[model samples]
Target: MLSWVDGRPAELLSVRDRGLAYGDGLFETVAVRGGRPALLERHLARLAEGCARLGLPYDATVLRDELLAFSRQLGEGVAKLILTRGDGLRGYAPPQPAVVRRLLLGGARPAYPAEHAEQGVRLFPCATRLAEQPLLAGLKHLNRLEQVLARSEWQDDEHAEGLMQDASGRVIEGVFSNLFLLKGGVLLTPDLSRCGVAGVMRAELLAQADALGVPCEVRDIDLAELLSADEVFLCNSLYGVWPVRRLQGRDWPVGPLTRKLQAIARDLLDC
Candidate 1:
C-alpha cells in the first residue's frame, strides 16, 4: 500500500502518532471512480464535522486537493484519509496546540459477488448491543470497538452482514451500514439521534423517497417490528444497496421498493 504522511510520502507511520496511541483521529474510506472520489463533498463534510466535534483543527481545501491528487494516481480503488492529533508527551490530557497528521493510503478495489446483488444477502442478529451516547453517536470516529465485536459474531460466508441493536433492545443498524425496513407499504429507518452512524447513502435514499412520493419515517425500531417487516435492506457508500434475503429464520422478498431505491443509488454512483 502507498501512503502519504503530512503531505509527504512515507514508508512507515510513527508509533507515537496519537491515532495509534489513543485512537485520537477520524478516517474516511472513499471509493475512487474515473480518478475522482465518489461523494467527495459528503465525505469531506462528515470529516470536518468529526474534527469539529473533537476540537481538532482542519483545512478542508488542503485535504481535498491532497486526496484528489493522490486518488488520481491510484486510477481506481479505495482511498483512505486519516487525520490524527500529532505525537504528544505522556499524559491523558490533549495537547494545547494540537498538531495534526494527515495520511492518505490507496489500495485495490473491493470485490462483492454479483450473485449477492441479484439474489440478496443473509443477515444474522448480533448479540452485541451499541451503547447510547448522543454526543458521539452518528459520527464515524476511530473508536469502533462495538463494530469490531459485532462483526466477529459470525463466520459463515453465506451471511453477508449482522444487525446490531441498542442497549434498550431497539434495532439500530448494521455494523458498518444503515438498516431500513418496509412494512405495510411504508419505509422505516432507525433514527440516529441516540446511536448508530448516519450513513451518506441513507440520507440520499431518504431524499429520493421523498421526491418519489414514498412514505418514509425515521424513528426507534423495535426488534419485533423488524422481524415482522415485509422487506428489509442494508446500505452503505461502498456497497451501494443490498436487499436482505433472509434474517434469522425469517424470509423476505426483494420488493419493488428495494429495486427502485437500488436503481436510484446505481445512477448516483454510476456503477
Candidate 2:
C-alpha cells in the first residue's frame, strides 16, 4: 500500500493536526477497479460538501484530478482520502490561515463472501445508538466514535454488518453501509438529514431507481418498519449492494427490486 499527504508522498502526521486533535476533517472511501474510481464525482461532491459544512475550504476539481492520477497508479483497490485542518496548537479555537492536509491511502479490494450478493448476509442489531446532531448530520466527518463503538460490540464475521438506531429507536443505517428497505413496491431509506451519512451509492441508486420507474422515498424508518419490509439491503461504494436476508430475527428473500438494482450496480461498479 502507498500513502500521500498534501500532494507529496509521506507517512508521518504532525501531532498538532486538527483532524487528530479534534476530529476536524472529512473523508471519502472510493472503490477502484481496473484503473478507475467508481462514482468518483459523487464522492468528490460529498467530500466538498462536508468540507464546506465544517468550515474547511476544499477544491473538488483538484481533488478529483489527484484521485484519478492516484487510482491509475494503484489500478484495483480502495482509495481512502482524508482532508484535515492542518497543524494547530492545543486548543479548540479554529486556526487562522488553515493549512489543509489531504491524506490519501491505498488498499487492496476487500474480499467479501460471494454469497452476500447471491443469497444474503445476516445483520446484528447494535446496542450503540447514534446521537442526533442536525448540524453534522449526513456529513462523513472525521468523528466516527459511534461507528467505532458499534463495531466493537461484535468480533465475528458471520454477521457482515450491524444495524444501528438513533436514540429515538429509528433504524438509521448500518455501521458503514447505508440502509434501504423495499415495501409494497416502494423503496424506503432513512432520512439522513438529521443523522447518518447520506452515502454516494445510496444517492446514485435513489436517482437511478427513479429513472427505472421505481417508487422511492427518503424518511425515518423504525426497527419495526425495517423488520416488516419486503426486502432489505445495505450498500456502499465498495461492496455495491448486499441483500440482507436476516436482521435481528426477521428474514427476507432477496426481492425482485433488489435483484434488479444489484444487477445495475454490478454492471456500473464492476462488483
What would the TM-scores of all predictions be?
Answer: 0.95, 0.98
Candidate 1 lDDT over residue span 42-132, tens digit each: 8888888889988889899999999899888887888889999988877778898999989899888879898676788998889999999
Best by TM-score: 2
Residue 10 CA displacement from its true place in model 2, Å: 1.2
Model 1: worst 10 consecutive residues (lDDT sum): 262-271
Cα RMSDs, all models? 1.4, 1.1
> Which digits, one per residue and each the tens of the lDDT, describe model 2 over residues 1-271?
8799987778999988999989999999998889888998899889878888888988877798889888988899999999999999988988888878999999999999899999998998999999999999999999999999999999998898999999999999999999999999899999987789999999999999999999999998988889999999999888889999997778899888899888888877873
Colliding residue pairs in candidate 2: none
Backbone clashes counted, model 1: 0
lDDT of model 1, residue 20: 83
lDDT of each: 0.87, 0.90
